[model samples]
Target: MASIKQREDGVWRARYRDEVGKEHARHFALRRDAQRWLDEVAAAVVTGQYVDPKAGRITWDEWTREWMERQSWAMGTHEAAAVAVQSVPWREGQISSVKSSHVQAWVAGESKRGLAASTIKTRLNYIQMSFRAAVADRVIATNPALGVKAPRSRRAEAAMRILTAEEVREALDAADEFRGFVEVCVFAGLRLGEAAGLQLRDVNFLGRSITVARQVQGSTIKAARIVAPKYESERTVYVPDELMTSLAAHVTRAQVTAPDEQLFVTPLGRLWNRNNAAGEWRRVRKDARLPDEVTLHTLRHTFASNLIAQGCDVVTVQRALGHSTPSITLNVYSHLWPSAEDKTRSATASFMGEIRDSADSVRTETEKPQVRGSRYR
Candidate 1:
């Protein structure tokens, strides 16, 4: 049941008892507005479908913490997810009350703050997913993120910064100090965490492959405990003969100090930090006179792009990258397909030609043969 009352200040209020026996009230400036709200509330109550707005009243911070608590992944990734979630524009306000306009404004602000498009897109997606979950849980009537627009992402073709073969050699040559880790990243395409967590036992010299089954995290070397790979699936990546020789030479030079020593470690025998790797890459890039935008991960991209450009199939690349699906590989590297434009043009021209030929044959057959033969018979 709902009713409208005019206050002494001439403001109208719509007060109602929802189907759940919860009281809700809203202030309106006009009588018509109050009446409209009252009518809607009454209808919802009568239909036994009234949902309490308070149920949706959670802050972005609160909901993200809940999500972090419930996630069932490796601790390293869970911590990463939590960090990403916390980086959003969280404030002491109801998550459901966040409108599409608010999200659009936030995105604009983030762009002005110079955050990368990829990072902003990722955060926006996480918030959108959080709202979606809220909607599914009946905590909100509708997801405010349903039609919200994210910042325009850079096109893959435009954003790709794959290093050339000569540039790769130069960068690798400059990174001779961390050559083992760099070699693994370049040849095996292992992620930074995977490379940091590599142990001697994980390498099978006889099998000519390395197993990617763990990752490392945190600042302290003592905190660098092993966790499963990103997808929780153990897989092996083959190493090239030249890279194998490099690995063997690197191991002999480093000299194993512990029974279970990590394959790539700092001079102090600590796990490598991605930031440190990136810093080393910056120095190496300067030494090689490469462009400023190039980083260590460019090596991985270069490897994948080279394979794709050389006619390696999507399935092979997917396995090498430890991707769960061929579609994932294709979506990321489809821009590397150099002949896409030419192939599209050729296909379109062939299709049109076929249509033209069929039309001409139909016209000739229809116009020529029918009349005289029937009259003679």
Candidate 2:
């Protein structure tokens, strides 16, 4: 309940207790203004929308630091999210002061600055997540980022460069000592970190399967740390005989017989990280004379392409490539799947061809009906 009265200063004062029994008051020059404020607070409380006026004064940086501390994200994920949080234009402003217009303006500015749409979208996602948490915590009345839209991603429309068998062979030959790493990526669809994190125990020779449970984090060996696979995509991936044989040969050649030893390491017996392997990757790419757009990741695309060509469904491809969802797999490789229209057209053409081929063997009922009435025809 709220009450209004004339204060000692001859001003109208409206006072009320919130749902939690916290007293609040506002003074206004006019009695109507005081009454209106009381009514608004009453309505907000009834609708379960009451927020402590002071709770939202925390700045974006302050709230984000608190929120991040509560998250159980991986080290790489935590670092990336921190970067996104730092990129917020309103990091120094109070969280409640942000409006939808401000978010839209920031997005527009990012686009004008020529940031990749994907990067902007990722950052926007992190912002939205934080804002949502704020709303749930009653630190803000609503999420300003709820309806904001990110710029369209151009990378989605770009053509993927899938390598051919001959190209794979040439790349393997050119990779020299790094052939095993490239082979795992191409055949098993492991990402760079996942491939580098492999240990002898991860391989099951009898089953010909490689278990992808963890990955090496950081860009260099000195800073590397083992972490769970991205999106918790830990599963066993079956490999072909050739890949299995290659792994065996690699193990024997490297003398890494210890089950806990890394499957792939530099010649110096240190772990292989992307930074240390980049120079050799460049040399191989050049020596193989591959397209400029073809990168180490292209081999992963090639693996998915082969699966789709072999009639693997979206779910199968998703699991094989360790994508978090089937939709993600389709988003990147939908164009590679044979369209229903193409299948229909091929079926109709094959049926027509069969009809034409058997046309001479067909006879109408009237052509053979002349002797049908005879008892012994």
Best by TM-score: 2
Question: What is the TM-score (0 to 1) of candidate 1?
Answer: 0.79
- The C-alpha TM-scores of every prediction are 0.79, 0.85
User: What overall lDDT goes with each candidate model?
Assistant: 0.78, 0.88
Tens digit of lDDT per residue, candidate 1, span 1-377? 67888999999988987656678899999999988987876675576544577876888788777866776767766656666666656456777787877777887888899988887877777778777777766677677767776678788889889887788788778887787887788788888888888888888777789898788765455566677777734688987788778887877898854636888877666678666667766888898899998877777888788778767889888988888999998889987876778779989999999999999999998889555556655
Q: Number of the top candidate by lDDT?
A: 2
**How well does model 2 score by local distance difference test?**
0.88
Pairs of colliding residues, candidate 1: none
Error of 2 at 354 (Å): 3.1
lDDT for 110 (candidate 2): 89
Expressed as tens digits, the lDDT of each residue in 128-169 for candidate 2 is 999999998999988999999999876543757899999999
Score candidate 2 by TM-score against the native.
Answer: 0.85
Residues forming the 10-long window of minimal summed lDDT in candidate 1: 42-51
Total clashes, candidate 1? Answer: 0
User: How much lDDT does candidate 1 score?
Assistant: 0.78
